[model samples]
Target chain A: MRITALAGGVGGARFLRGLRTHLDRSPGLADTELTIIGNTGDDISLFGLRVCPDLDTLLYTLGGGIHEGQGWGRADESHRLLGELAAYGAVPQWFTLGDLDFGTHVVRSQWLGQGLSLSEVTTRLARRWGLPDQRITLLPMSDSPVETHVVVEDEDGQRAIHFQEWWVRYQASIPAQRFQAVGMDRATAAPGVLDAIRGADVVLLPPSNPVVSIGIILGVPGVRDALRGTTAPVVGVSPLIGGMPVRGHADACLAAIGVESTAAAVAGLYEDFLDGWLVAPEDEASVRLPRATVRSRPLLMTDTDAAADIAGAALDLARELAA
Target chain B: MRITALAGGVGGARFLRGLRTHLDRSPGLADTELTIIGNTGDDISLFGLRVCPDLDTLLYTLGGGIHEGQGWGRADESHRLLGELAAYGAVPQWFTLGDLDFGTHVVRSQWLGQGLSLSEVTTRLARRWGLPDQRITLLPMSDSPVETHVVVEDEDGQRAIHFQEWWVRYQASIPAQRFQAVGMDRATAAPGVLDAIRGADVVLLPPSNPVVSIGIILGVPGVRDALRGTTAPVVGVSPLIGGMPVRGHADACLAAIGVESTAAAVAGLYEDFLDGWLVAPEDEASVRLPRATVRSRPLLMTDTDAAADIAGAALDLARELAA
Candidate 1:
């Protein structure tokens, strides 16, 4: 069976790892072919180096080279390059880009500079991580640039900054007035995105930021249409549990747009395409879905085993909906 | 007194280190201002990063961060980026560019991409190393591209390869027919090259590769004219000892032009502008000069002490010629 997953950076990758583990541990899912459409809205070019933070996180995590504690970047990484860059007084100093990570940036930036589309460059980079053997395909949501920009009110007035600066530099502390994924009006989905959705046996949304991760993907032209029109069940695992995010600044991002950081509100936001919803057991009583099949599960992914169990529950819900 | 020096990479850097030490140790020379005209023939673009090998060696060495044993690059440097770059199958595997060294390249490439000349970018980088405190100003031989290409007879036929490929990859084993500094014809001296020569009290050429290093510098339009027309006494130290180069593939490079690796032969190559020559004590008897004052010293830079002594002797010779 072919499974399509939409992912962001660390949290999404963690969930996907669990799903892959669950498939391996379970029988019938052995031949499952997984194709992940990753969010590229967070991608940016700094110092002429193309840095795809979300896409790189997926590559490093799945390839078993991720900084396990941080869930992003390479393990045993050094910031020598970044330190030296700062010494030169290069701007945008808050981002902690590692030396090993710079290697990926250098290669990707070189390819992109040579005129390769973000999607094409991403697919080529995944090959280095042994993606074929893992039966996992990672692709950017679109070939064109769709950078997310956040509008905030400073002392002067209201202004916009790239999402990276807002998220990394400010720690999302300032309330964002609005979030906009620039260039979404003209950009269609990447080459295989619609095809993967149309051909999938099931579509799973991991526990990633709904505002920027899956939300940005859905903003692309025809992406929501494809998701809503696909015959397969579209299941979502809420990133929020017990009125807060599992990890990341998702709560802050959600609050920027005035959405309560609750599992039920998250499910409500995806009510159009979501056919099945997996909420945490603690918040089961609070969820009020009009039509989707809602299931309660222990959603604390404290360990691999817990993550696998949560993933198992979500898959079971999707299977029931499909039947 | 104002002193100007011509230099290359490792050997040139070693000589400069010695010269800087000699200036520091000698009485009444503490206030001497030094300017180094570095060869840019070995500069290459790897993975789209502008790497000026000769200028970098001078920066790292004079700035006290050079790999003391190797006489080039940074000490305690890591190749994590280089290793990962190779894993991605990036080419030009022969050169071992360390991670710290890559920082310099990245900064330089970015600056060059921003429309800064190679000379301007170099001066900005030197600021980070406290060049002013060292009483040193380093400039490229030419702001325009002046890459040396080596013509060699391959199995297919005679073809020109980059000087780096000829020197590093082939190890200079293939007999070179000739050397060409591509784009040297249209290239003029860098901003201060001629001024440094005209303004100098003494000019010294360190023991560097005569053909590719000093020869390429002189190939730039107006550089040779500056050397010959300058009122300052010009002196050179033989890289060749009795009948062989002390280091590098200089002997192989000189052989390409049919010049014997002897003290008198090297001096004859520079006979036009040379006013004094410094050779090894062992090679003093064989030295034959038509016009320049010839002197002998222990030319092997076995240590800083030995190198300082040689530098001192060369400066003394230049002073005598001036008188």
Candidate 2:
């Protein structure tokens, strides 16, 4: 069986890691292959090196190199490189890149500068993380550069800044007027991305930001169409629990797009294709969909086992909908 | 007094540091401004980051951040970044880059990618190293991209590889057939390079590699013309001690250009513009120049004081020639 998922940065990575653990432990599903389509809208060029935050998080978290406490960067990482960069007064000091993490961006930039596509680069990076050995193939959503920019009003008076500045720098305190994927019109789905969605036995959406993470990926040409056309049961795990995001500024992101910060509203964003929805126990009663089956579960993701339980519940919901 | 010097990597940087020390201690020379024209032929793009080895060595040495034992790179540096790059199987694993050194390359690449001239980028980097505070101005030989490629024959047959690969990786052992500055045909002298030489009260050449270092700088259009036309006495400290380079592969580099490994032969290369020559005491009798005054000194830069003494001798020779 093949399971395809669309992921964002931290939350999505953590949930996918849990799902991998669950699959490995299960008897019949142990041989199931997982294909992860990572959102690259958050990609930014920092210090002249291309940085793919979401893809790197998935690589680290799934490969057992993630800083558990931070849920993103590498474990046992040092910041001496960053300290030197700061000494030089290089800009955008808000986003932290550890010395170990810098290795990823450097090589990615080098390969990309050499004319390799983002998919090829991500495949190489995944190999280094031993993802192929675990029957996991990680790919960027699109090979073309697609950066999400946020429009905000501040002392500077209405300007568009890179999504990272608004998210990592400002902590999203300033109200965002809207989010724009700067190159979405030109971005075609990466090789195997459409096939993964159209041919999967089951499709899962991890608890990534609905407004920015998964939404930006869905904006890719033919991606939404592929989802709606696929015969597989599409299951989504809500990023929000009890009307609040478990991590990141999903509420602010939703506000920018004029969507309510609730599991139902989040599910509505995927209503065209979503056949199964997994929500937190407290929010399950409020989520009612005409075309999708709704289920309730404790979704704190307090530990690997708790996260596995949540992921296992979502898979079970998908299986029920398929049956 | 205004002093100008042409420099390379380790040896030149150490000599200049010593010169700076000497100038600071000397009564009248304390107020003197030093302008250094650094060779860019050895520059390489490692991992897509612009690595200006000669300029960085000068920065670290003059700024008191150099590793005294190694004569180059940052003191108290970590190799975590390189270690990670190696793990990713990035090529050219021979030339090591410490984490701190990577900071320099990262920012330089970033600025250069943003369309800043190499001279402007070097200025910003020099500012961080407090070169302005020391009243020291460092300029690259050419703002245009100029890389020295060496033609060598081994298992790969006759092909041109980057100068750094020949110097650092192979230790200059392959017996270079010839040295070619790849972009020198289209290259023009960087702003202030020619002016620094023409306007200097004294022009000194440190114990840098005569062929690859100083020789490459002279290849820039109008630089040698500036030296030939300048009124300032051009004095040079020999890199050789008893027909042998104190450090690096100066002999190999000289041999590549069909020149002998002798102070006399080196002085002959600059006979048209050289007004003063300081050689090792052992070579004083043999080094006979028709126009340039030949002098002898203990040229081994064993320590700061030794280097300073040699630099002072070169200045005294320049002053005597002027008188």
Identify the candidate with maximal DockQ. 2
Model 2 stretches astray by more than 4 angstroms: none
Off by over 4 Å in 1: none
lDDT of 2 by residue, A1-323 (tens): 89999999999888888898899989999899999999999999898899999999999998889999989899999999899899999987889999999999999999999999999999999989999999999989999999999999999899999999999999999999999999988889999999999999999999999988999999999999999999999999999999999889999999999999999999999999999999998998899999999999888888888888888999999999889
DockQ of 2: 0.88
TM-score versus the correct structure, for each prediction = 0.96, 0.98
User: Highest TM-score among the candidates is held by which one?
Assistant: 2
Kindly list the per-residue Cα lDDT of model 1 for residues B143-193, writing each as its tens digit.
998789999997979999999899889999999999999988878899999
| The 10-residue segment with the lowest total lDDT in model 2 chain A | A298-307
Clashing pairs in 1: none
Tens-place lDDT per residue, model 1, A144-206, is 888999999988689999999999999888789989999888788999999998889999999
Tell me what TM-score chain A of model 2 achieves.
0.99
Interface RMSD (Å) of candidate 2:
0.6
Candidates' C-alpha lDDT: 0.88, 0.93
Docking class of 1: medium
